[model samples]
Target: MTRPLRVVAAMSGGVDSAVAAARAKEAGHDVTGVHLALSRNPASYRTGARGCCTIEDANDARRAADVIGIPFYVWDLSDRFHEDVVEDFMGEYAAGRTPNPCLRCNEKIKFAAVLDRALALGFDAVATGHYARLRTGDDGLVELHRAIDGGKDQSYVLGVLDQAQLRHSLFPLGDTPKPEVRREAAARGLLVADKPDSHDICFVADGDNAGWLREKLGDRAPNQGGAIVDESGEVLGRHQGTYAFTIGQRKGLRLGRPAPDGRPRFVLDIEPVSGTVTVGPREHLAVDGLTGIRPRWCGTVPGTLDGPGVTVQLRAHGEEHRAVVRVTGEKSAQTVEIDLLDPAYGIAPGQAAVVYDGGRVVGSATISATRRAAVSAR
Candidate 1:
């Protein structure tokens, strides 16, 4: 029998988290529920069911803890959230790259900060509702893998975690599907059972990335307006800001003119300093290789980078691409070079390229550069 552990459950006022905490308690673990206060003024954050880490979410989490018969407390991590996740996000956009803030939050806040605090407070592990499976490998190392429910697998974001973090983390709801979790939440008398799943960037409030960036960046924004150019250096249109566009974006270009070949155009590149937004045919967005920096390994550091059967995931919900990975540099300067056997479209810098050996997560790296597929525009 496994020993009972003192676990801190991170309740996000969502059905999954509530059910996870309840399951942990049921498993004979000493569990305490804690809600993260991510927003300085939660009032300005999203209300209703749209986004999480709001004032309403904290209350909901407290209520769920009450029902689960566990002690609950709110940890004020607004300052950390702002500096790590929020600021990093703004800075990435300003640098003309697309970063996954969720990945950063998991790396810096949830695992790094929260796990550090939990260990300091005598907790054996910090449990969350993340849908990723953990198992002890033959080498006695803990491995992170995809959840049984493929549709809800979140191992991609969690690929940032290292061996120590995985050892001290618990995900009780990984094997169960989302529907079963909701039903279990209802059975446990948790009020958040019917709460809608949070969507988009939690801090973005409204879904308008451009408008929100414009407001936050203010005078600090690169340019109020810039020229949108095609691959041939022909100016297609003007955009309010380069931060407003991302690679592979087809909508909202407002180009006002179609391509010479009458083909729909997509954003090809973003140059923040020059305030240049490049647009071209969709074929131009295909990338065959990428250079990834800041590699974070989950378990054993892979020695054979050119081995077969390696796959990489570039987006949160994106499909896996078979690739050959090579590691270069040393320590903090180490970078990964991936040659994708299957070309991916619109892959952008600052995005995470999660490496997976089958279902098990090996590690992840931040995409720094991409090699576009050879193609000539019409």
Candidate 2:
């Protein structure tokens, strides 16, 4: 019989995690469940009708742990979470860039904080319900892979994991579909089996990010509202706040009149300093290349200066584009240049460009600039 492996699984009081714990135990591992206390006021957020991270979730986790005969503990990580994830989120929004808090959470909280704590407590591995897989290659290097359940695959959000962290991580739910996880939870009589998944940003549970920012930052600076213009600088309509809009957004512009060409208009650019929201035909939004800053390679594999071709995912659900990656520095500072195969629309700065090689994730970098073919000459 195989020896039991000591594993600490992060339990979010969801069905997937409950089933993950069950699977880990079924695989003959000594499992301990941990619930990360990320928010000081979890009750304020409505995670569907179920509420979020409330006392109820902790109780449910404890009950599941009891059923599984594994010990359960809650770790208060609210301070770290706020500093690493929440503050960065607000800072990005204030800087006129859209930030993926989930990515930040995975990079800073899950892999860094939780993994660190688990190691300090003498656990051999840290596990989570994230829909991503890890594989040990012939070279003995750990590779991050897309989950078997492609529909729920979450590798994009976990692009920042280094090889060491991946080596000591387990994703028991990676091979199971969401429905199957729920079924497993039910089979084990776990109370979270039918519990609805938390959809909103765990911290900003209300889905009103702008409102949350307003409360935190007070009144925003009053920049003169200006025209939503076309590529030729032709004025289309007025806007309230450039920060409130994003690229490819078509609604709520409140244009006073219809376009002469009768085609729908979409926001193409947001100039925060000028408070200009530029709107135009959809074609104007396409771009073929993006430059990323602070590039981080997942493994110790030094990035090549000669550049290598890779598949780049610019957004969470965005389609992958063929690109070539070139690293520009050594040591603490590095930049990545990605040359795309085809023009991508609505590319936003401060978003992550997750690079993937086949099913294995390479690494990710922050989008700092974009180059449109038309504007490059100028």
Candidate 3:
């Protein structure tokens, strides 16, 4: 609520985070920079200064802290990250679901685990370089908002933040444009000023998820051995495993039977138990509605959201769709049902379905299941 508050700047050894910590310090906050060592072996995580989990990143973070004239420390969060984010990622894929590790990290790591530790250590808040804004809502409470720059709006990824996390978080890059942040980093003499932006999944350093999963899971990997099937339970071909297929994935099916229209077939379903990968035309991926498990509301979910005002975001950088959410059940069984106004494709399970009320993120939920709109491939 005031400047000069004790804050921990979570530096990622990139220009954005470097500039973020610098901004927090410049604003008179007693900022202490901390770099999270998220890999079991830093050297083998991701080579070069291009990735967040690399040793170069840690060094860059320390260098940034030096330039900012603040104390910096490297915290080993590898164990927690492995348990919460990495393990969960493998588990989801094993179950024929696609999980967003970034969202998981935001929910379980940066905000939950790290915030708990920071609070216990007497830090008022954790500041990051995420492109998001915090403003007092019409209800007079702090609320998360999309960044002013629509292109860099990371509200979708940060949609996992709940009321408590939002209150104790600061995003200094919220109002600053991407280019401006780089310029600021350059002006401040931060060593990471020219570092490349990290992309893909940080933990999956090589970007080869299938190969990585195979190595990690061994015999348990989904693509290790499976059969390719059709909608009617007819086996079309043989496959290595089913985890390699996701909803709306058409390119890698390698199916011989093409539709009458000669259009390529797409992966429609993944039956992990049967070790069966279902293939169908693109229309089969259309979903009527989705049920999200473990809903995390950003602020508060109104009691009665009967129709169409609810906006459902299925991907981190995808378009929002109109829907209606009904908060059902209670406790661990709590879930939300979203009925889309128009059918959407690629509604994969285990992916997050973040809900929004206007420009503000109202809440988010992990898609546990989807009710597909029936389609006849013949």
Candidate 4:
């Protein structure tokens, strides 16, 4: 006989999450719902089908919990969220690194802080509406897999989850499609069934990160005008701020001059100390090798690959590429040397590199440096 697991569902007041919480109950888990108040100001939530972390979201989560017949509570995590996510976000940008706020939230807040709180409070596991599947392997290890709906798969955001977090986490909507989850929510009489998904960062009120940082960081937002240079150290133009540019960005470079070959220019590197944003032809963006630091593995320590056997995902919605990865660092400060079978463009530092073996998540790490193919200036 299976014992009923005591679970805490992290409700986000969205259709998918509402359905996930209900599914937890259906699975015979002794479930309770909790809404995280990530914003200090309750009314800061954008009006009409936009934004997250609003008082309305908390209320909707409570209502969903009512429909699920589970006890619900709203926890004020605004301070912690600001310190861990918002500040880290600004800090990364200030240091000339592009950081993914969602990935940080999942790693620090959702899985680490919330999961820890749940276990301390006697709950066995923390459940959410993330679109990722879990399977128990023959070795009794829980493996993370891509969701059934490839379009809605959230494994990219969830690749930050370590083995401990994966062990105590639940994702009920992984095997279900997004539409089916919405239908389940409607069938269960949850009002959030039709609530629009919050696609923007929860704390960013206007969805303009650059603008928001300017207001918050004030003179510290890296908005100082900087020189735009080419690989040969030739000054091509000037930019308002290095933060405004990312690797592979071309459109907004506003470079009055074009390359000698009349080809487009792309951002190749960013040097914050010197306030320089480097640009080059599109070919210069190609990087054949990458070294990743600050690593996290799902299960086993990575072994050498003889061929392009492993898959590497560089961006959230980006295509997976075949690569050969070699692990080369110690336990806590782990690193990996990845040799892409094909040239990967726009690979940047501070961006996470998630590895997979087929559909299962193998591990993840932060990109530290790149081995770019040299390009002759035209």
Model 1 whole-model lDDT (C-alpha atoms): 0.91
Provide the lDDT at 342 for model 4.
69
lDDT of 2: 0.79
Q: Record all residue pairs in model 2 with backbone atoms less than 3 Å apart, i.e. clashing.
A: none
Candidate 2 lDDT tens digits, 1-378: 547788998888777777888788889999999988887776733457533667677777788888888999999998998999988987676666778888999989988999998899898888888999888788788888888988888999989888888878889888778888888788888888888887757766677665666666544534435567777888777765565677778877788777778888888877877777778777777888888887767775446432344688887777888877777786577888888876788888888998887777888899988886464321
Q: Model 1 over residues 1-378: C-alpha lDDT tens digits?
A: 589999999999888889989999999999999999988877644655566788778889999999999999999999999999988988888889999999999999999899999999999999999999999999999999999999999999999999999999999989999999998888888888888999889887667788888888878877777899988888878888888999999999998888877889999999998899999889989999999999999987775565566899999999999998888788769989999999999999999999998899999999999999888645
Instruction: Please write out the lDDT profile of model 4 over residues 193-243, one tens digit for every residue.
Output: 878887776677666776777677768865587899988999888876677
Each model's lDDT comes to 0.91, 0.79, 0.84, 0.85
Better of 3 and 4 by lDDT: 4
> Candidate 3: RMSD over Cα atoms?
2.1
Best by lDDT: 1
Q: Is candidate 1 or candidate 4 better by lDDT?
A: 1
TM-score of 4: 0.94
Candidate 4, poorest ten consecutive residues by summed lDDT: 301-310
Model 4 residue runs over 4 Å out of place are: 47-50, 221-223, 306-309, 374-378
Ranking of predictions according to lDDT: 1, 4, 3, 2
Which has the greatest TM-score?
Answer: 1
Tens digits of per-residue lDDT for model 3, 1-378? 466789999998888888989899889899999999899977644444334678778888898899899999988899999999999999999899999999999998999988999999999999999999999888867788888887888888888888889999999999978988888888988777777788888877767787788788887664568788787878778876666767778776776777657777888888888788888778888998998888888877655464545688898888888888788787567888888877889889999988877777887889989998878656
